[model samples]
Target: MAYRPAGLRTMDEAQDMPPQSPAPAGIGVRGWLRWAWRQLTSMRVALLLLMLLALAALPGAFIPQIPQDPAGVATLRADRPQLATWLERAGLLDIYAAPWFAAIYLLLFISLIGCILPRTKAHITALRAAPSRVPRRLTRFPVRDTHTTTATTEEVTRAVRRALGRRFRVAVTPEGISAERGYLRESGNIVFHLALVGVLVALGAAQMIAYRGQAVVVEGRTFANSLVDYDTFTPGSMVTGDDLDPFTFTLTELTSRFTVDAQARDFAARVVVTEPDGRRYEDTIRVNYPITAAGANIYLAGNGFAPHLTVRDAQGQVAFSQPVPFLPEDDFYTSRGVVKVPDVSPGLDQLGFTGYLLPTALAEEDGLRSVHPQPNAPLIVLDVYTGDLGLDQGIPQNVYQLDTDNMTQVMDGAEEVKVLLAPGEEVELPDGLGTISFESLPRFAAIDLRYDPTLPLLLISALAAMAGLSASLFAPRRRLWVKTTQDEAGHTLIEAAALARGDDPGLQRELERVMTAVRATTPTTPEDT
Candidate 1:
């Protein structure tokens, strides 16, 4: 054999080795899938997915959602048809239910599960094992101390064990004593991720089984908990009519207050609710303060005026007599509304009216404008149309808008007919069609009812996540070592050092504290080496 140094190879031996081959072939489908899964399950991907979910929800806040505000969406579509089309196509109007948003949410959920399982297994293994063995060279640690004392090795070891046992998991051997603590740091990290997964699951359940409905109830009118009673109802995938609580509520009164400059000050809606068990109670709904009825939350969403009107045909038969809600158009309560009289007498064309209601009517140079939000001088300015009102066509239509596409505008001589009437005023329709009367004006309340069984779980999970995150951020993970040796002078030489998993500002202080505990047990003062 050639005289080769230990751990050395000769030229012939090196040449016999296999050459570094060209880059391996492309990873097969299975390998590629494994790589993808690993990448998707990484913490970085989970955080990125979370961020994407948050960003995707932003559009729902700014744009009008069909489930929440169909009227606003209708107006948007009418005003900006192109933009509305693009938004609808891109799912910006209904972001939370979008397929892409759901994909990110599902991916995040899977990633959290994937990360938690492996880490939890490892943590269990670590918990079963003892503290790591003492390092060969304790002097290599940044936080270190040495004490020369008259105490024997046995005394020094006992004191060190006693002191460190209070807070750390200690392991004593002939070489040294090894101690570790702050397992809760990793535990809290795992707990935080688990809590986040719980939150996501709760939220998904809520989305799948919850229901929300909105109804505009005029004062003295009853609203029943049924599909037909709601002006807008958005039900989750698993929700149905039977899922709604059987209840009935009537808006008894709605009070409003406004500042001099037409700024709204306060609004309250008093309602009488009848539960499914026949229990009746009176409650008030205010902005930001919701009332519970039949196990569902009733929120006061809006308040406006509904004018009580009566229409009579030429035969003196009552055609339409009910309150019609006029949606507000401006801060001053300049409202626009429509009335379709589809039940006119035989041989007479249906009647339709499109008009504006000025709460505090003021005759300006251009036209009538509202000066305040209060109904101090309520007036209605309407234009009459006579033809098919489109109610019997089975196609859903917006109640607040009038479709004059198949109707003819009533005319007086050479000009289009327009009627301006105050409260309790009666006006004769041109061409002997009918007589319209504005009887009274009563306030209406837009009440929203919501039900979700997973709300409490979601709340608890969110709070737990915050707590676990706090523990993970503040708790410190550190390892400590205490070694004892005999010096030439026959005194015990104690050496202690600490190593932390991350930056620990109190590491040096901890070393000092352990040293102090040792000094207190020894008979002689500690001498620095």
Candidate 2:
């Protein structure tokens, strides 16, 4: 018979009692914040954020970026204003620089740091501490072995410790010797995370400090490394015109080849570069072969022909005289160009010519087009216009397009007037407007220059990350124990066992090695030891 305490409730009474204090107030804001932090800093969340970053970058690849392809973006806007407006509103046109994209990048960076720091701290602590103690029952371990030898316990213990100490960190315990190896697995994990953080930092720095520009250099004409000289220049957030390298280069010659079917075979350009210190050198640029100068890489992106022309007003005074680069329209070099002669004689109206330059002219049934990529039958056919060239309007215009809004096409009877000329050929303009001469043809090379100071750091970080990942994946982590005791029969009994942190196919073999080491030092009997 037992007597219960007077104030203590029986099982029935406790069951009938009500809940206490609303279950302790539901974990408040601070507790919830701690939970959120733990979730965000988890390795799973870090990987998820990385995947999200990659997914967010996919749209940037397909969309025409405003910084890299401003013309393409402009054309999209002009063709589909509504769609373009929506894309702009969503920041797809400048996806890399978008606020949401930056947020994801920053979050991924922070998550990686958070995940790495705690793991690093724990790993350091583990490395400094001793190996784990041996289990009480070695026979229960998945990989275990027992051996009976005619030797003392001290001899077996010495042999086991010496054998395992060669490869593992051994610690003496009351039960036996505890040995551990492959801390490098955790070390590699920490290094991989650190490298990822480094890569993020380097990328962020590059985005803020790098700059790129494109310029067209005609043969025999020099191109200066300046903002005004570049046809299109995109600077980083922290970049400025003053940051451009002070250098100049002139396109000396161009060599191009085409197949019989008008497909391009090869293109190479020779340029003379002059550094800021007045040192000059010649370099060749071909497709995929870039030149490094003034801390920037110069790549030959495109090649075309620029026809030199001299235009004279009615008074026979030179009005516009320079080379005009034509944009290629086909594989055969059927090019289109516009000549805006806004600087005409004082009393004469401004003249404009919109035309096509056929490298190897061929008269087709539908129209005229180039038959070859070379200048075998070079010809320029143009339609003449007279107007207020709109130069004083302070509005930007495409050099390849002519605005006919304030212009009238010259007419000869019922048809609009047209002029045709070949190299060194001259033609008189109608109404005594001017005389236009095709002086010569020179090749032009479109080059892109880019400078990023963080490229080397980014490359190193990427390589380090790969190496650390390999180590983490291939290096095995294991903890082993070797216990020895003397039985009443004056025989030493040995129990060897191994435990792996993760999947280790060699755990059984490792335990066998320890058992073999113990046997080597002791006299074993043929009793299934």
Question: Quick one: best TM-score, which candidate?
Answer: 1
Q: In model 2, which regions exceed 4 Å deviation?
A: 1-40, 43-108, 145-174, 257-267, 313-317, 329-334, 345-355, 360-377, 381-395, 402-420, 429-433, 485-494, 502-524
Per residue, candidate 2 scores C-alpha lDDT tens digits across 1-529 of: 8997889998999999997765557788999999998998998998999999999989978888887778789778877999999999999999888999999998888888889889988999999999998888988888888888987777887878777766799988778889999988778878888988989999889888999888889999998989899998888878888888799998999999888988788899999999988999999999999998889999999989999999998999999999999989888888999999988878789999999999999888997788998999999999999988787775556888998999999999999887998999999999999799999999999999989888898899899899899989988899888887877777777888899987899988888877888888856776646
Task: Write one digit per residue (lDDT tens) for candidate 1, span 1-529.
Answer: 7685787978888899998889989989999999999998899999998998898888888899876677678778878999999999998887777888888889999999988999999999998899999888987887998887888777887788777766798888888889999988889899899999999999899888988888899999999999999988988867888888889989999999999998888999998999999999999999999998777899999988999989999888999999999989899999999999999999999999999899999998998899999999999999999999877765568888888888999998889899888998999888888799999999999888898888898899999899889989999899999888887778877888999987999888888888998887757644556
Note the Cα lDDT for every prediction shown.
0.89, 0.88
Displacement of residue 6 (Cα, Å) in model 2 is 8.0
Candidate 1 regions off by >4 Å? 1-111, 150-167, 260-263, 408-417, 512-529
The residue pairs in collision within model 1 are none
Which lDDT value does model 2 have at 404? 92
User: Model 2's lDDT to the true fold?
Assistant: 0.88
Q: If scored against the real structure, what TM-score would every candidate get?
A: 0.78, 0.77
